[model samples]
Target chain A: MYLCISVLVVFFQMELLTLPALRRMAICGGTHGNEMTGVYLVQEMARRQKEEGDKAWPVPLVLVLSNPRAMQECRRYIETDLNRCFTSAILSFPITDSTPYEIRRAHELNALLGPKDSKEAVDVLCDLHNTTANMGVTLIAYSPNEWICLHIYKYLKGKMTLAPVRLFMVNIPKNEAYSLESVGKNGFSLEVGPQPHGVLRADIYNYMKEAIELSVEWIGLFNSGVMIEGGEVDAYVFHKSIDYPRDPESKQITAAVHPQLQDQDFCCLKSGDPVFLSFSGETVCYKEEEALYPFFINECAYYEKGIAFHLARKTTLKIPSVRVQRN
Target chain B: MYLCISVLVVFFQMELLTLPALRRMAICGGTHGNEMTGVYLVQEMARRQKEEGDKAWPVPLVLVLSNPRAMQECRRYIETDLNRCFTSAILSFPITDSTPYEIRRAHELNALLGPKDSKEAVDVLCDLHNTTANMGVTLIAYSPNEWICLHIYKYLKGKMTLAPVRLFMVNIPKNEAYSLESVGKNGFSLEVGPQPHGVLRADIYNYMKEAIELSVEWIGLFNSGVMIEGGEVDAYVFHKSIDYPRDPESKQITAAVHPQLQDQDFCCLKSGDPVFLSFSGETVCYKEEEALYPFFINECAYYEKGIAFHLARKTTLKIPSVRVQRN
Candidate 1:
């Protein structure tokens, strides 16, 4: 049963005629061990899939449990942050005395699900994450302008009607992408949060499972040549990563994000609005002239890295084509 | 500034004229290492106290960082649940071949806070804890029949106006008290929750710190012979620990607390109300007739010990004669 379907597939390009079909999809979880949202969701999906006797995705899914040891320890990572270890440059570095647990895990995962740059690599990837930041159902796009990525966002928005999907475009400096999704050909990371690192909120857990299963279903549908609608999604584009106010003397974060602005993530921030408040009772305000949105406020995992929040700008993403292939 | 004061501090027996002032109160935190509400709250309180320079407590306090090394690792405990490690029977077993890390710490703590049956021990103690259960500002009383326990309940209820206080009376067989506060003459354990272990929620942290500081102030006021109003507090008294529905063959818990009952802790439960739902699509209803209350639903840490929830009965506690001596 081979069928030719015309759809706008993202090949890292925005084109109406690109009709590439999803060959294989990989759903990676426990990329950072303490991110239990992905870890449990992946485990549940696998259990359910096995129990139901292989109602497998028409396109095979490579389930990667990136760091089992770290998950067991209930720490973010046993050594280095796994989420930050998946770069070609880092992978090329020799496994040395200083190489951490996650760095080695990344090399293994890349071997299993990658080399994502090769022709036989998985067609698409979806990495799951949870955060202490109140980022409700966030989709971070590594390939934002492409058709397949936009369609995935549109399908996710449609299925998760109650849990709105907010999109963030990933724009890092030249030669510095450090996410698991970056190792895949076409993919994005889904983050649901305000959940702490080592714990699973059942509500969030169920929702994330749904998000993951739906992605697999969507991939199956794509494999079956199902006509997907090219729809528009509102995304808060990445502008810059904002860090916590650090003390000059000790280099430690000395301020907390202002209470009012604490979880008002992705909301428009006006100039002169209070942002961070120091232990000494000094307030840091948003001094930018243009109104910007903020998210990832007080992410617990980011404490060591000093990221208080990320600044973003609201933008509309349009997807105008849809097609797939089946055989 | 020596002051003569005589407060009717309950000496285990509510003798109306037993005028023993609250000479010293011990505030213990991290009784369970992963309970970050106590850990962070205690840390914050200690930091604030040191920074503000001794605003000396009238009653004097001994602050115990109950399990510092365990807290450093962010686990419930290094070897055993520290809350369950304080019994005299266990502590008296001596340093043996099987002594775990927490057991040694318990011996050290007993030497510091106890000789539980001695006069030199702290007159009152309040241990702080956090749970994954959706319990908000709970007070667990070792001796619910005593006057001091009821008074503490009344005071906490009055103070935590936005967040109500729920009470659980600790009633175990003779010679078994599983908490640090049990060693003190008069005290209770305060638990704030639904916050995951090893993570800090700002809101919960602030509330817990407020609860801790208020407890200290109340102790100080008691020492100063402040006349407190005799009020009544509604408490949900502990009845039984409820386990989740388990599969008969595997003996594994196969059900989760029903959505309606998950976080509806301390709410009245009628006979036949849905309590748990099995993976096999069966609903386990609350089959008891007389109206009862439920709390401590779905505590994450309790999963290992097989507790799904707890049943309680609501009752009014009266704190009638509130008088103290002063000169």
Candidate 2:
């Protein structure tokens, strides 16, 4: 009888620590107006919602087209990048008549779906994006320990057949996270590409659409009392970014990504590998001491940010199996 | 004695009608600032001129960066597209303080190299450009009868081993022409692509470089009084452009270029071929009854211009062999 009582005590403790079921979610796009896949996907969802109502979704879903003005103009942003205006400090800034359009929009978005770090925040958020780099489909999250995002990444990787799926962890604190996806209790970004800005490709659009559908399916399964089994996932952790070789006086780029390195994202680079080809027909070699994987190679949008590419360290992350807790 | 006098008279008549040797040439780039191959090729040539002096060229050459402000911002244009601002009517407009930057720059370019229909204009002009379409290497001209340009196109087609070379005739009248290359006596644009705007690829840059070098070599040979042989050349004549499917209410694009059609520039399209894929996964087929070649498929910069792709008619032109005239 004493042994039976001890077993019951342990079961009670396990129930207290179980995660709650996610009741609300948000999907956003057009944070950068030039990225067309996201813009179209969000628009498509909104059209369906208007025609059929929200009964189609298992969870209450909010569809957001961030930076409407930028999307209308078909530009990246008006004053500053909207994706970078979501940090706690930027969001709390007082509104002024002279404030940029994006910052003001950020506040409106936070009020509607975020109020971040609070219990009222949506359970999941997925912001869609596109890149000119040949990185295939990538899931970007702020933390490696975000089990919800990691499990979704694993689910997407298993289900997606057209392209390789990968996870990229930015590893920043929640308060310091700058992207629109960071506003939810469990948030991440879905980035797919090899597409140019302001241009849409049918293959790329299909990849993004498939990912969203799979993510929603996973969410519905978990909510309906299905325990999702989790395992190890290979994730790329952000290391550093490198800029193109530039002229000293003019600060204009003096070279381009080497032919060998161009379009070769997520490939390991070691010392003495050719990285750039100078306009004068000379090759520039990588000089780093250690080998690292590079992604976002020659992304069109990041040219303004002075990033030719980003390097990361690949690591295996162990995620815990999860099931929605009963009230 | 009578036969000798007749031959002398015919020779004299031919000398009077012979075309003048090209003495001055201009090469311009950055008319669309985001086309990086042109911007870098012009920069590289300027650097060589600065380091090697005028002795590097057999003819007096002028290198121009057509849109400095746009290049600095890495945008297609700041206020208006510079490429579309070169019509005679636009160039003659009175300059006001509020005049668009591109127009002001156009006037500056006109005064420096053009004075369009005058003897003082550069003998030959080659404007460099890049497109996001998989167009290989293209020489765009206003008239198929322009012997100098046709011969250059033929020469480039024979010499360029990296990519296929073809001629695209805009077929517009000189006074109504709206491009920087129209400012010269015998002018055409060398366009190469499949590279994204604001990003450079080593292969694309090399193709542009090789084309430019071969053009210069052809000019030098003609100036040195060597006969250039010409033959039948195939050129695409502009027909019409088709816009993407759009929503009636919002006027936003509702479909994207189908995967089957994307990157298949210069391919023949017939009735009932897949052309676009709607956001909801429906395939839209081509409805034109006649077969035609399509080029500039899904160009990034043309989204705002409402052009999904351009249709053209391919025709063969017979070009004549010629040698430069000597005084």
Candidate 3:
């Protein structure tokens, strides 16, 4: 009942504000049910702005409170994660035939948030999420075209605690035809952090606001037929694996250590401890390089092959300038 | 500028009402940019409702205006269809890449739209689209789960001109990993009509709005832990191509047809169509009654012959339900 009522209110409000020249931005929060920071942050911003007489709102922003059931249950989702389920197959779900509850809310939000015409306000989609293990910000983007990402990156730079690193994480394999790669344009996954408690709430809210501002500016540039600065970034791959003693009780072997680096920072290990090849592949012998590879081990897990171990190390590698490759 | 400002205002405004208890629905319009009816209809309804001074808005609807640039150009999308580019490889554009104007626009729209999340408001994601040649009200669904589609079908019945033939009209191939299917327990596509003049806008709006109401009711029923009176529908096979046609023109056969049949309409094609006996077979042929016939065509255009054929004519054959064979 509340969901229906809220949709109507927003739908009507959008009607009042409809005009050809209107600029619009759609903001998404709580993509993962556990990533509640974005959800809370948007709501708090709205509440505070209203209390302040709406003077703080700079652009027409559509704040979406996504995945209510997941939020309530504090789970990723009842059946599937909403963030990962944005495809045509959604139409097959009987519940989705008429518009699933979440889809309906998103639609209502989109209408209210999108620009009046295709040529008007810039269309922007911003999904906020937190990570379970990774500690920095990563923007999983699509296009190698820089104009789009640069605009967003400019705005998101300072507002976020960790500088956003943009990269193409996956390609549309022949098998997974419906993956986000299917969108193949410039979709991105904004991974916030390693589960920052309350920090993400504020950061995401601020990031969204900045993104809205940038969108307005970007749209104005487009309307005037101006080319924005910047180019596409290439995909960055971070494959980090540790070799555990095939035995469970034995401690993991130490390999050459890489210095700690910030997000986007990349280090090249030209020479390290002799590469001790494991069943999986080549891994730096941890124990032999302990002095050079100062590290802290997290909990260990047993995989099919061996006992897997996780560790945090430091590096002083330079962040490489990358280019996005569009398929 | 107006769009940006309006978005800012709405963003904050929606945020004000985005408390934990509020119900939400996400409605996506123009998944295929040419399907302007749903987009326009949603906008019109919101406009009319607001203009009429209706103080009470029924539901919190998030209207997603997908692919504005494509819609403006009256094309599905440039470079690549935005609908088909949702995979991870194409998520974000680079900071220095140069591409077509439409591709960049797609990226911008994605950035603006972001991903779906958990909030009370975003319970559903209604993707509205139109057909190229078929003229019917058919739903493309992810699963045949009746719990969701049955109610949607009920609400959609008699509301629009398109015939709601069955509970579900679509199923993703096992190989197709769609986002919506990956998210909810149920999902579906609301394929409106082949309206040439975009006259179906009103009907689309009415169906969508009514569907929202039905979805809300469903959420209520489910949340109350009440067992709704509906049997689960079995998963169906989604065949993109039954046979890989050897001829160029003959290859025009498509799966998206307006099936002209009553309730359970299916097809039973015999031995004449070209069949790739093995997974790696690259031959085409017309199936004769009981013989595995072969026909001469192009030598090696494709790697493997397709097991399916394009439906050239709209024929309603009383075919038995083919068991869904997983890929």
TM-score (0 to 1) of chain B, per candidate?
A: 0.89, 0.93, 0.54
lDDT tens per residue, model 1, B7-82: 3343212533334677778888888877766765555556666776567555566778899888776677888887
User: What are the interface RMSDs of all the models?
Assistant: 3.7, 0.8, 28.3
Q: List the residue pairs that clash in candidate 1.
A: A2-A327, A6-A323, A7-A322, A7-A323, A8-A322, A10-A148, A266-A294, B6-B325, B266-B294
The C-alpha local distance difference test score for the whole of candidate 3 amounts to 0.40
How does each model score on lDDT? 0.73, 0.89, 0.40
lDDT of 2 by residue, B56-93 (tens): 77777899999989988888999999888889999899
Residue-level lDDT of model 1, residues A182-220, one tens digit each, is 777787888998676665555666667667767777777
DockQ of 2: 0.69
The reply for model 2, stretches above 4 Å from the true place, is A1-17, B1-18
- State the lDDT of candidate 2 residue by residue for A1-327, as single tens digits: 999989756654453224688888899999998898989998898888888887767777889999899988888899999999899999899999999999999999999888988788899999999999998999999998888888889999999988889999999999999999999999999989898887899999999989988888888888998777766799999999999999899898999999989988988899999999999999999998989999999999888889999999999987767888988
Give the best candidate by lDDT. 2
Q: Which predicted model would earn the best TM-score? A: 2
> How many angstroms is residue B242 displaced in model 2 relative to the true structure, after the best TM-score fit?
0.9
Sort all candidates by TM-score, best to worst.
2, 1, 3
Candidate 1 vs candidate 3, lDDT winner: 1
